[model samples]
Target: MSELKKIPADIAELSFEAALKELEQIVERLDSGQVDLDQSIEIYTRGSLLKQHCEDKLRSAQEKIDKIVNQNGTLGTEPANVE
Candidate 1:
């Protein structure tokens, strides 16, 4: 198995949608099996970073939403239901 490479610092600047789109593209490319082993490893590493970035974005958004819901208790919105 190939070792994972460090995530590029620029990846942090990408928006969640962009990262997700790139990750989806990576998945499709790997699924197609057209990529050479070396290229696949490189992309797979980057894809892992993108996946982590997307998850972090979602987690941040969820926290913000939960905070808003808590502050507006009158709305009676449950955080669990937001998901």
Candidate 2:
């Protein structure tokens, strides 16, 4: 049997390398101005998605921080003291 692994494809799941590569290509295409009007719209749509993916990845990383706690009465971010 062959081994297979499942990987995330959400914008947040993209590696820094992959996202940067795609962003570079998008910039090149936008600069060339060779795409027909119809194609330009399509490329623009793709660029929007790539941008959003990168942003979502950053947001997810930030959310994972902010030590949330539920102690003594309420739930919210509170500094954790480890001893």
Give each model's whole-structure lDDT.
0.82, 0.65
**C-alpha lDDT of candidate 1 relative to the true structure:** 0.82
Model 1 lDDT per residue over 1-83, tens place: 86545557788899989899999999999999999999999999889989888877888887777666654446443464433
Which lDDT tens digits does candidate 2 get at residues 1-83? 64322323664466756875787798898889888889888777667667767666565555655445666677666553332
Question: What residue runs in model 2 are displaced by over 4 Å at the alpha carbon?
Answer: 1-13, 68-83
* TM-score (C-alpha, index-matched) for candidate 1: 0.78
TM-score (C-alpha) between model 2 and the true structure = 0.57
Error of 1 at 45 (Å): 0.5
Give the lDDT of residue 76 in candidate 2.
Answer: 68
Best by TM-score: 1
- Show the colliding residue pairs in model 2: none
